[model samples]
Target: MRVRELLNYFKPYGFETPDWMIVEEYGLRPDQIIRMDLNTSPYLPQKWLNSLGSRISKLRFNRYPDTTYRELVGEISRYTNVKPEKIIPTNGADEAIDVIVKALIDCGNEAIISSPTYDYFRVSVELQGGRVVSIPRKKNFADNVEGILSSINDKTRLIFLCSPNNPTGNTTSYDDVLNILDKASDVAVVVDEAYYEYCGETFIELTETYDNLIIVRTLSKAFGLAGARVGYIVASKGTIKMLNKTRPPNSLSLASIELAKIALRDYETVSRNVRKIVKERERVKELLSTLPRIYAYPSKANFILFELLEGDAKTLHKKLMEKGIVIRHIELNWVQRYLRVTISLPEHNDRFLKILEKILKEKT
Candidate 1:
């Protein structure tokens, strides 16, 4: 028997799981591991646990979740000031990306993406037989808006912009984004604010003024509900209607929907934790800066992307792994010299930095 040949696009997509996956796959215990990878919120709110308990006992498990996810959409609408009809909830922001890409781009259409951003955008676009045109960032990891606009053409259907970008903790200027929208009226501009809580900046309001803009957000970072897998997109009603068609019926579980409702009601806990993480993030950056061979970037997100001034980043990562401290190494060609570290609780950040400092000294 012969298997059919897979599409050419699938060939470029490699299957190397991130460093955090290896840490978990190795069966390393938490007490022995100081994980600062994958940008996950280190603290799960106590209120989420209470909400989960109430939901497990009270929710009607036999019935499906509200197909439209009305309640969750309403809560997010009230928080974001967008109408419920303009929002689409999904399993995660990753799902929102796939749904939107599928709805907008056909085979052979182009999807423009800013490089050194999230990989999932390219992966999703490629899986649908869409071509990905990369606009490389500047030396400091800033978006090259001029280059991006120059690359767009009549065939370009979508553009993915990750603000306060992943792997490089800086945001694109709001004005630059607006300029792109002005130039490319035919292409959809997706502003992914997965780390919006940490930055407190957004283009959600722009959706009202521009028909081509869409903003995506997640509850995982600030709301501390990563495991629950809740995320949403805000766009004009027409764009949302098209995206809704691509989403699976009742994609969110009843338990996750109910838990998200409870979490939104108690917003104070999420706000407090986000503030704490931002504070701890600055502290971590300052401490790391003083070390002999470290350079920490200023971040608007809940993580820091830093570089080793005088050693191989992979070597440094290995040393940390041996000591039960895990951090993400930036392996992409554009950022191979850097490493991304998530902001955890105060003590956790302290321990990771302490171990990191010792590793730097040993290398010297």
Candidate 2:
């Protein structure tokens, strides 16, 4: 289909939102709802909140930020151990994806992505009037590297790899990434490391070796800065220069940049929080496993994806909602009967486990 024709039928990606109507029907306040759907950090301690709020007043909200975002780039460069010239600060990882798509994709061009992964990659590509070539992941939710590599042709301009993939909560293998990089030498390989802090494995160093590699990172996940919307792209100097052309000027707010700087400076604190989440994730996974009907998949990310063996996923989702809890019931064409819940504070985790166990038991 032509780009203009496709625009008429285009469906913008809709982000998940809590069912406020359900919340009202249950007679519960918004604050009372235990949010385990979004893969964001649990409530921050007061000290962390204070730290994030400390310098907001100093930032000139009335004035435009440095369009180049030089200071933020320097901080990100220091944090990621990449040179400053190779980094481009973005509003969020989503924007980073959009910028990459904008720079590389033209009408009728193509971008390859693995199925049951983040939808934004597909959206970004399609928005640029580029076609999305989706390759299904392996049975275990690993990227079908061979399929992806084979699908690449002259028209393929971008390949998005979301490590520690969302909803599925799995990482792409290092060797598999290298294999693709070796094969698709001409195509831009975009490695999204949004969840890198959860799992220490990374393809960042590969960027130095392969000029076609673009590594996208964000403070959203482990750093608990989702609202701040700060992410950066790491690529070769030439690639960064090209992406900068399409990146929106002053896309990041001064407040976000300041918060990101604070986040990078307080790496120790973020690390501590990440460790706690990882520990909690294991505990939650074990607890979920005890439920005979739910098969929780192994995950390195902050969330768990599981299949409902007996009960209807939508029913379970509704039950959880009535009980003032929220988690994602994943609905996609290639996958079914799956749900995901973010790992949260121990008490919150315990509540969800207790409620879920009760619901599944009653179903039996």
Best by lDDT: 2
TM-score for predicted model 1 compared with the true structure: 0.94
Which stretches of candidate 2 lie above 4 Å from their native place?
1-5, 18-22, 48-54
Candidate 1: C-alpha RMSD after superposition: 2.3
TM-score for each model: 0.94, 0.95
Clashing pairs in 2: none
Per-residue lDDT of 1-364 in model 2, one digit per residue for the tens?
Answer: 4557776888888777655865668888877799888899984546655765777777788999999888888888888898999999998899999999989999999999988888899888988899999998888888999899889998999999999998688999999999999999999999999999999999998888999999998888899888889898999999989998999988888878877887788788889999999999999999888897999999999999998988688999989988888999897554568999999999999999999999898883
* lDDT of predicted model 2: 0.88
In model 1, residue pairs whose N, Cα or C atoms come closer than 3 Å (at least 3 residues apart or on different chains), thus clashing, are none
How well does candidate 1 score on lDDT at residue 145?
Answer: 94
Candidate 1 lDDT over residue span 1-364, tens digit each:
6643445326554444554665676666656777677687887877678768966977887989879888999888888888999999899898999899989989899999888888889888888878999988888888899999999988899999998799788998989999999999888999999999899989999988888999989998888788899999999988888888898788799888988888888778888889999999999999989998788999999999998878799888877777777788886554466888999988888889888888888883
